[model samples]
Every structure is written in structure tokens, then in C-alpha cells.
Target: MTQAPKADSAALSTDTANADGTADSGAETGTAAPPRPTPIRGYFERPLFDAEAIRGLQRVGVIDVGSNSVRMVVFDGAARSPAYFYNEKLLCGLGRGLAETGLLNPEGRVRALNAINRFSILAEEMDLTSLTMVATAAVREATDGEAFKTEVEMATGIEMRIIDGEEEARLSAQGVLLGWPGARGLVCDIGGSSMELGEVADNTVGRRATSPLGPFRLQQIKGGKKGLKNHIRETLTELRDKVGGDHKALYLVGGSWRALARLDMERRGYPLTVLHEYEMTPKSIRKTIDWLQDQDLSKLRNRTGTSAERMSLVPLATVVLRQLLHVFRPKRVYVSSYGIREGILFEQMPDDLRACDPLIEASRHLEEASARTPGFGRKLFDFLMPLYRNAPPDRMRLIRAACLLHDVNWRAHPDYRSESCFDTATRANLGGMDHKSRVYLGLALMNRYKNPGSNSRLTPLLSLLDPEDIRHANMLGRAMRFGAMLSVKGPNAAAEMRYYPKKEVLELILDPDRQALFGEVAQQRFSALAKSLGVSTKLRVARTAKLEVAKAELANGEAAKAETSS
Candidate 1:
């Protein structure tokens, strides 16, 4: 299970101290710099971290031993976003035959043991400060679960904490709130052996319950479809009693539920395939379930690229979902890729850290690591404040995040930079934002360099925005383009820009000496900006005694005639 060693000589170069004496990077600071890439799994075979060198980071490993899969996730940092230093999973089906045999599947037990042994070595290699293994219903309820736990512990030298159904529900609900700051909903997490229901209101967990409504358990019930429906109804009634009333949204966790959502995407040709934050109205989800009930599951399996095992469980999940919708009647349904492991991470974070905005923190990290001028983002935001000062709080947040990320991808190929920016905004492992905000931010970045409407490949994504959204995105892009020069020359030393929307005039004011920097290209871009705003342009200088309006060179030329006429 050991991997070959990876040496990051380049990263080592960044660890020296600056002239002022502060550490240049993690090396001199005696902190674990953000992890450098190692082997494919990143965590295995890395050099051990010196205890004193692991500042600002607390690496915690969570080993989830579920009925269907065994996974190990090492979270390297304790920021608002989860940074997976190392992650590996194996489908061991440790609880496959528990219902019939009344014990762990003998073959599955062996496979799981092997996986756990490998995970233990991997965890040690990662220098994981804290590594804990948590097993759910299958291991907690099985007759020989304790004996299996003893065997696993003896083999891996890692104790497994078997969590009961109720705790499982609570942890999964907490996971939802970790990604969504103020989530209010019913969290339904379907596992291989059981399903848990929990209510969350105004950022706190409410009533909760667990049931044997999982596909594996349902298959064990006597009778066919009719019997399964009756059992689901009975279980749902009890679940409703525990977690009563309608919720704003239904947060779905677990592989089977996600698989269903993915299939729903494939069926509807959803442009954004990201499962996290993907939303559905109750009616839409109900329609999908109805459509699934009559379709040939084999075709669906191929169409959605789902495994036969997962496809098989969809029917049972559909039945459970139908009943859940009927009982909860949520306004919307959302799928969260996060779950118990994220819950554990969230529980460990201090209140201040938990309260930080995940998207903004992640954007700031990207800017620090990649931008040529790191602090320029904030400066650019400050300079452009006049343009967006009237924007709503949510809109301003997205604009601020976009500013931070504006130059992070400057290293990309010139022709591909816009596409790269778009992809990163839409597809990065970002949390805490919904799909609409994701698209808005992505489109703004896309329009930053090239004109966004020209790319047909991006048309599908642009469908998420309306005309007003596109107009606003274009305006943001133009503002970024105008302010890009402020990065090269420090923001304070740069010229100022003024806008007169009522008079349909855009003006640039420069210091007399700094006027040299505003050349032909700058004027052309300024003109383009004016054109975008449907206004005329003027150039002026900040003089010793008074602001002087210089004679407009471009405005009198044929260039002005062509631009203005066009």
C-alpha cells in the first residue's frame, strides 16, 4: 500500500525568510505549507511533518466504514472549505448479507479488513494528527458486529467507533449545515442498511429518527412492490412523527440518492452536472420518480452511466423518495456531497472559523497561491466600489470573490484563459453557494477577457442567467478590464476613473506625470468601456491647481468616427 516518495524541490524554495524577517512561506514559518502534490493520492508516501512545522493546519483523518463502502479522508486544513489532503475509498459491501445472515458478510469482512489495514498505513504516512474510524448501522446492529470490530482493530491497530442510527442522522444533518451556513430542511441520508431522517431549522438540528427503509433492508421484507410500499408508508409515518412539518428544502446525502440526482440530470440534459448544490423542485423530482418507475432500468443505467448495483437501488429509493416528498413536502430538494466525515470536521472547527464564508475564503486562497499581485484583488475591489456600491449584499459578495480570482489563472494559455476561468468558477470544489450564484460568478469571469457571447460551447451554461444577469456580468468584466492596469502600476499610483451615467459620459483623470501611462491602447479600451455603457468618453489630468480637461485626441480622429458610429 506504500507509494513512491515525491520530492517538491520547487516548493522548498519558497520557504525562506524575507529581509523583514517574516517567513516567506511554510518552510521558514515552521508551518505545514498547503500540501504539495505527491503521488496520485497526494497523502501516501509524503515525508513526515515535523510537529513544530505543522502550524496553521491540523490534519484530521476520518475513516468511514459504511455498509457499502469504506473510505479514508484526511482533511489537511481547518478552513471554511474542506481541503482533502488524502482520500481513498473501497467498495467492500461490509454489510451486504447482514439482513439474511444476521452477521457481517464473511467475504466483505475480509475485504474491509484489508482496506482498513491499508488506510491505517496511509494515515500514518500522512502524519495525521487525529485519525478516527466511524462505522454506522450495519456494524452497530449486526449480531457479530462487535467481533468484527475486534478483528478489524487487531488487524489495522485502529479502533472503530460504531455509531447508532440516531447519531448517524445527527452527524449527516450537521454535514449539511457545514456546507450550507443557515440551512433549514429535512436531511434524509439513505445508507445501504438504513435511512436516517433529521430536521434542521435556522442553523440548528431539530427532531431526528432512523428506519430500515434502505434498499438492502427493503429487499428482505416479505411481499413484492405492494409490501414494500406499505412498509415505506409505515416507516415514513414514524419518521414524520419524529421530524414533523414541512421544510424549506430536502437535503439528500449518500451515494444512491446522488446517483438518482445524476440520472435526473442526464434525463433532463442538465448543463451543470455538479451534484453538490444541484436543486430540484418537489414537483420536478416527483415527475422524475414517476418517469423512472416505468422506464427500463437497464437503459437508464447506460444513459446515466450508473453502475448496475446503484441502478438497482434506484427503484427502492424512488419509492422512499415518493413517500418522503408526500410527508415532508419541502419547497425544494438539494443534494449535498458532504456527510458524516464533513460533520466531524465541522464539529472540530471553532465558531469563528465555522462562520467564515466558504466561497470567499477559498477564493482568497486561490489568489494568494496563484495571482502575480496577490493584494491587488482587494485594491481592484476598492477602486471599482463606485460602480457596484448600490448592489445588493449577496451580489457584492460574488463581485468581491470574482475580483480576488480575476488574475489567479493568468498562467493559463492566452487563448484558453477565459475557458479556464469559466471552468474553475463553475467546477472548483467550492462550497456555500447555490447554482445560480455559481453561474453568475462564472459568467463574470468568462467575460473578463474575451467577449462571452461569442463562445457557443458556453451557451449552455449561460442559459442559467437572464439578460439582466448577462448585462451585469458584462459590466463587471469591463470594470475589471479597465482596472487591470492598476495591478501593474500600484493601485494608489494609478489614475482615477469617473462616471456620469445621467450625462452619458465616462471620464479618466490622471496625474500629469502618470498621463504617459495612458497611451493609445488605454484610450481604446476606455472608449470600448464607454461604448459598453452607451456613453461618450473624455480624458483629463489632475493638475497642481485645478483638474484640466485635455484636448481629446481620439475623439477628433476617424477612429472615434468609426467607433462611435459602430
Candidate 2:
């Protein structure tokens, strides 16, 4: 759950104290020097207070407890994608004897407990902002569920939830949907304890069902075919009727089945294999399932696909995969590289925030709008930031991405742009969204400029979304429009756009009798937005002693190319 034992440890070479927390980095500070990473002068509660100090970013760790195994993931703060820095999984089958027995065995419980303890220590030492731990079917169904949870929390200081079956299915689908673009079909999450079947249509989720035959349960049923076969048959019969014929394109998740597929591919020496984009035909899948069915537990242990700890659960996993294939008869099975961890990320977000796809619905809309007006979208966003003095720093970046993509609709046909842009962003495979949620985002984008009597195709779309998201789309849309109007001549064709704030009215130092051509309409729109958005709009043109703009290297950015070469 934790990333590392140490924080800060900035790759800095020197340090110096100031009246504020800002420090100069060097071997000498023109005075006696302290260590490089020490808190600066006059800073109380250095980590939390220090008004002028460098604030640290927060990280969240997501842990998943499954029937076959448990895993932990840490997303790094510094990386561009906030890439994964630590990922570890252990297979401790509390579910192994669960079919015959009602609870976890003594040995299995000890092993699982030890793993949780280690994770807890790491989380503490690494200083994770928070950790979300969820126990799935194995632990949920165990008679000693509450006791097991108590032991984990007491031992590791990490509280866990034994989430219900419906919650599990919803989260599993959400996690997969977070990074899945244009994914509309069924999600079949086959775990050690149960099979969760869900649907993502137009980015909305409906009909979540958790089937009885988990890998462990199915294996037991297969082992005692004459006795437990009817149970397995009945479960599959119910699942087939629920899935019906049309929604059989499967988005496969959970470890047992993924491990099986990975092992089969590794054995066959298929060089190109990436789990998220991993593909397999029904024929290939059937052959792999058959091979797995033929093997005994010992053979499975010796096989390449089996992890050291998951050796015992092979019999159960194979049976579940075979039974599902036989009963549901899906056309294709697509492997998912994400599940509960991602779902937990979605859960942590505010409820209204979850109604739409965050990245796709928001970021794409603004980026496209900037492209149309040949405006300084980024600069305009920076200028407008004074309005968000109390907003979270992270939200600042989100607002920026939204502004950049605001004009994406301009690329499509003008009349249907709002609707089309809404559709494109949600369904275009943008990261961090499902199809229906993406639809909601698209709808929000189209309705950003909602006006009276301008609610035909857009009204039904708006009905499916959260009201706040619609408001956000408008705020973002206004900023984009303001930025565009500033470019009256269109993309440097001429300098018709002029900016002058009411507080600092235009004062030219040109010839006393001369006046430059400044468009009145553009100026009026600029003033309106400045008042509306509460931004200080500024522009000045005067004869100065210096004739050309200077090129200087910035503290963070490099100098202009002409200056660099010189």
C-alpha cells in the first residue's frame, strides 16, 4: 500500500533559509547553512503550515482482496501519467477449502494475515495519504468475515470492508471502464469465489449479477460432478438466461482467468502480449480451457501459468472458465488489466463528479475549442486562474484541460457539433471513463451554452447528466469563447483583437494625433468576460526606448531558439 519509506528527498543539491519558507539551493547561503531538505525559516507545522514552503502531493493506494489472492498498487505522484511505482500480489487461498468448509483454514488465514501486515507496514512507512481495502467473495462469504477484518485492522492499522456482491460487480466494471474507451458490452469478472456479470452500454451501467460458481466452487463442483454438477448447471443456466444472446462480448477480469491466458500465451511463445489489448479467439480460448481441464492440480503447479501461491486454486479456476465458456458461449473474450483498484478511485470521487467521465468528457472538449479560434487557450487559462484562489491545486489542472478541449465540437458539423462532440469525447476511448458516463460528459459539453428554447436533441441528453457538470461545461465554454474573441483577426492574420481592462484603461504612447484600429465589438466582449469571470484583462502598446522583445531563459523553461543558438 505504501510507495517508499521516505518522502521529500528531492533531487536537490543545496539549500538556504529565507524569512519565508522559500530557500535558495547551494553549498553556501551567504551564512551558516543547514541540510538540503530541512524546513525553511519561520515555518510552523512545516509539512502542513509553511505557507511559502513547497507543498507535497498526495497518493492513494488501492488494495483488492480476492478469493484466489490479494494485491496492492501504488500510483506515483511525479510521473506524467502518475504511473505505477509499486505493485505486488500474493496468492493465499482462504477460498481453497471454502467449498468443503465454511471459513478460511488456519494455515491459509495465517498466510493472508502476514501479507496484510507487510502491506500495512509499507503503507505507514511510505506515508500514503489514504488506503482503500475491499474484501471480495472469499472473505465476504466467510463466516469469520468480521473477525478476519478486525485482525487485519488491529495488526496493520488498515481497515477493510467486506463489500457486497452487487457493489463488487459495480466497482469491477467501473475500474475496467475508467481506462476503456468506446467499450460497450458485458464485463465477465471471474474470481476465485464468484463470477460477476455486468454491462456498460453508452457509458451507463445496468443489471449487475454475481453468479454462484467461482473458480474454487466450480472446481469443487467439477471434482464431484455426479453430486455438484446440478448446482453448477443451474447456476450457468440462470447466467445464460440473464446474459441472453446479444450481449455476449466479454470483458474478462480477475486473476485466475488472466493468469491462465497469460500462461497459455507464454507457453506458446506469443511475443506480442499486452494484457489490456490482449486478444484471443473463441477457438484459442477453448483449446486453452481444454488443456487446463486435462491437467491435475500437480500438473497445474508445474505449469508456467501458475503462480507459486496460487497452485492449489488451479483446479477451481479451470473449472469456472470451462463452465462459463460452455454455458454463456461468448464470441470473444477481451482481457482487462484493471478492476477493483480503479473502481475504488472512481468511488473516492464525489458523486456528481462520477456521473460523467472526468478526463475524456472534460479534457477533449476544451482542447478542440482552442484549435478553432487560433487563440491562446493556455495563456488565457493562466490569466483566468485568479478567479480560483480557493480551488484545489489539482482541480486547477483539470480546469485547464477542460478549457483546452472546449472547442473539440468545432471540428464536426456545425449544427450537430454539440451532440457530436458530446458523443465523440465519451465514446472515443478516452482514458478514465465508461460509455454511458462518457455520454453524460458529452451531454454536459453540448449543453454548456444552453439557452432558452435551445433544448431539442440536447434536452434528453441533459436529462441523463448531473446539473453541476452542465454548469462546469458552461464556465469552461465561456472561457474558451472569451479566448477566441480576443483573436478578432483570426490566428495572426492581423492584430485586430485588443485588450484593456476597466481598472487599467488603454493608454497608447503613439503619435498624439494617431490611433490604432481596435475592434469595438471584440473589446466589448472582452470587457464583459472580464467582469463575468472576474479576471484582470490587460493590454498596452506604446513607443518605448527598446524596439524589440527580449529573450531570456526562465527559471523553469529554456530560452527562445534564437537566444539558445546564440
- Tens digit of per-residue lDDT, candidate 1, span 1-566: 22111221121112110000000000101111111111122111111221233333467677889887788888766655676777777777777878898888788888888899889888887776667678887899899999989988877777678877777887788777767666677888898899988787655567778898878788798878888788888888888888886666788888888888887776677788777867776676777888886889898788777787777788878888888888777767778887887776666555555556666767776776799976567667766776676787678878888888889889999988988888878888776666667777888787778775664587787666667888788778777877776437443345667777788887777767666777776677677777877889887777733322322331243355356436
The most accurate candidate by lDDT is 1
Which pairs, if any, clash in model 1?
A: none
Q: Estimate, for each residue in 1-566, the C-alpha lDDT of model 2 and write its tens digit.
A: 43322221120101100000000011100121111111122111111211122123356676677787777776543111123556777777777778788887667688888887887777777788657677888898888877999998787766687877777777777665544433566777777778787776544456677876776766556547555656766787787676564664566776665666665565455432234434455667667767766657565556554566555555566656666667767666666666666665544433333333334233433343346642234445544454455655334444554445556656677777666765554444344332223433454355433321355544543443356655555555554454454433321222212334444432222211122333575566555545544555655543332211211112122234235335
What are the per-model numbers of colliding residue pairs? Answer: 0, 21
Write down the lDDT that model 1 would get: 0.70
**How many clashes would you count in candidate 1?**
0
Using TM-score, give the best candidate's number. 1
Model 1 stretches with alpha carbons more than 4 Å out: 1-58, 489-492, 543-566
- Which whole-number lDDT from 0 to 100 does residue 55 have in model 1? 37
